[model samples]
Target: MKHRLVTATLSSITAAGVAVALAACAPTAPDSAGAASSGPSDATLTVGTTTDVVNYNPLIGNSRTDDWITDLMYPRLMTVSNTGAKEAQLATKWGYTSPTQGYYDIRSDMTWSDGTPLTAEDVAWTLNEVKKDKPAGTFYGQLGDFASAKATSKTHVEITLSEPNSSLIDEIGFWGVVVPEHVFSKAGSVATFANDGKDGGWVGAGPYTLSKVQVGQSYTLDRAKNYPLVKGGEPIAAKVVFRVFPDVNTEILALQSGEIDAIGDALPPSQVAKLKSSSGIKVEEAAGLGYSHMVYNLDNPDLAKLQVRQALSHAVDYDAIRSVVLQGQATNDHSSPIMPVLKSYFDSSLKEYSYDPKLAASLLEQAGYTKGANGKFPLNFKLIYSLQDAVTSQWATIVRDDAAKAGITITLSGTDRNTYLAATNAGKYDIYAGNFAIMDDPVTNFTLAYLPGGAINYTHVDDPTLNALIKKASNTTDEKQKISIMQQANKVVYDNVYDNIMYTQNLFFAHSTKWTGFVPMPSDLLSIVNPVSLASASPVKQ
Candidate 1:
């Protein structure tokens, strides 16, 4: 999963409204003989989410809610399995033809919801258009080295790159959302096209199609009649509805009251235990492929110093935050941008930052910072975080208190998710605290987060040494050599204290026990409501 730039406004949902919404959206009840009386066509699966779907265009929308809805409608060439391996979806097979050339054999059985054949031309056109438009989403960054894509045959598409990139296939195949060329070729500009489907021109090639959208309320999708991914060539649920809530508390309430069959967002760590004890709920846990971190803007004079950044990293109490704030739900190991789950790439030799206010003060003194009459350093900084994130909200105060112990003056700024993202994109904050849903590929992750002019380079790091190492790693085809290069790059990042990785949390998702066949993915964004899982899931007959 990639980062989203905007989040919709929170809609207030009263208890009375929950009852009415559930009555209208709930699935058909099971009857005698362990079967749905009216058959699967009457079945519905309603999911609860905290954010609303603001963008319907898969190529540009980056929010979790946006991905969840668009992914069901727009099919990808490849998808990740439970263990994060690339699996074929719309493409039957894919392989590299040369060091700088790759190809995919598109499946011929797939067709758009409007009865248009999904062919290699559509795949080539979508990739080429994205490269030309350079949209502000996950796909453009991955296409930095792409030259062009051409359809060799009706079922085959070839991609040419300017340089050798071993990770390009996995990154683009799994992350790229292919749209029908017939429908989108008429748009004025791909970057500005909303593709909201307001005119009933929604065309898709996945298991479902966008049928209705009630802004700030719910997004409804109808199952396609000829989806070849499922057992019967169709999804069990005839309709999938995503209902919006103001926050996680309301979502949990809706799940408990049987209003929604599952929650699209990960359960807060503190609420996991109580939800597990409740009947009719099944809690599933997965290894995290992402980590929460705080990035310091290198443009700031104080943060530019090595000792200042090092002192700030050591000032915070990492152990207490993991134990108290995370409730021991996160991994208590060495903190690095590359999570511990990716053992081959994670550098274990790097030393972990220990909490010692005395050491922090000493480092600050060595950096020529003197304390004022108030017994605090002359440094004052503001940290910005999302107010919707429960974990960040609770731990931010702890971070302020801990930094104060080291004679550092700090201010906390919490805002709505949309505002927080907007300010971050505008470089309006001194220190940015946030988390990514998934970073499955270390090479791609490093390029986007640390490389110069990268999409999510919030820290403003411009070290030539780090940039060279990442570039060298990205141009290699050998797996061992790439790992070695990435490990060296990770060391460079750790030594510079470019970012403070807080913890890698084990994500937990809760769904109704009445439903079965839910596939669990690694990231919270794709845990239970992914395309494969939703298509295979059904009401567990009595």
Candidate 2:
């Protein structure tokens, strides 16, 4: 009855009317429920972490930690398994509906903790709504491959795109990143949907349901009983609680004091040795599909020159930074914007620019940037970095200091994540230091930084050859052929030093012996709480 009134009254409202209409359904409660008895020993696990879930909607939050909690209940159609294979979870079967259309068969037995049916309508609604939102910048990744979506039946959805898409179903549906249609169909600002702390205010169909939510402080999730994938058993842990800390030190302290059983943030390399020596703490590391790199604002006169860009790339002591920062835990990167973790697409033969301070100086001199009277190039760059990202800040500082050896003058600016991303995407920074959230595939990933006037390409890298290759790669259906073309284009981008990628990241984590059965993932990009990783998590046996 409540849902009927909501559907008839609010779904048809205009964009202007939506804000007022959905504002009432917004009276919220937490997401998910379960009959599983909350136990004592392994029943409750409190995870220490940073960042807060400011919004319940996965598509809108500014906090990096929001997904760590929201994903618990929203559940996806599929996810990348710990073995790196495509693992289906939510959608039982999927295939092409037409040349440019795809269809998914949602699992039938699933339901919200409230017993509301978890249907294909939710999947279709999420895709269609994201398209309607038309978010810019990094948010563009949320909409995935669908141009639009529609549910033909309660259990079937067809997603249509201009071209046959091979990536979206995995990236978007993996781990059930979408929210329930019944919850959001009447939502005005999806961003404010999780504003209340009432029971069942949130809605999801994952293994766990959110039992309580106190944004910025803590979130508690209860294991959904008889979750289909668990073989009619509940998840290993009955309750999972996440608490936020302001920084890494506080998190580490919480673990040591036994106030928390684990942490979600990747522990930086500088602290690994100390944690490794602590009794009862287990450290886990994984190969990364992510990379941290510096991007140039090519609009600037100096960075616009290929020689100048190449020289700056040569200025950083990449190996030294890697050793000091990563403590030999990461793999060396190649020149390509794509991380080497993608076995098929990464062309390891392409040489990265070696750290050659002398060569850096010569290139600058040859480009008519010879050391001026004060012994510095006329270029004065202000590097914008995220204040919360200590590693990126250190990377920026190291580059700033090293560039001086090549007579390059650089100023460092540290701002919060929102400001840093906004400034970089708005083309306000000369150089930006950050990590690239590459997609599951190389072709889609490269478009962010390589396509003609690419959305996030601050470098203004509008190379005709790369643009043509991007088009060529996107047109194909053959896996090997796509790899062949993307690698070729990747080499071209590397040749021009479009962006200086420092290393293929190796994200690390540590947990208490109080819990175990965790199956480590190939990349922390999928994270510990993701379906595949959580499937392997059980209490450490005596």
- In order, the Cα lDDT scores of the candidates are 0.80, 0.67
Model 2 C-alpha lDDT per residue in residues 34-136, reported as the tens digit of each score = 1122222356777887666655666654456666776677776755533233455666665553445566777777788777888888788877776676544
TM-score of each: 0.90, 0.84
Residues 1-542 of candidate 1: C-alpha lDDT, one tens digit per residue: 11111111112223242210100111111232122322355678999987777678888875678889999989888766434556667766665656677777877788899999999999999999999988887788888888999999989888898997767766787788899999889887677779988666599988889898898899899988877765556778889999988878889999999999998888889999999999999887877777888899998999999998888898899989888888899985476887677777878787678888999999999999999989899998889998777788889998899999999977999987767877888898878998887787888989988998888888999889999999998887667788899998888888898878999878888889888767667787677788867876788777
How does residue 394 of candidate 1 score in lDDT? 86
Best by lDDT: 1
How displaced is residue 380 in candidate 1, in Å?
2.5
Q: What lDDT score goes with residue 406 in model 1?
A: 95
Clashes of 1: 0
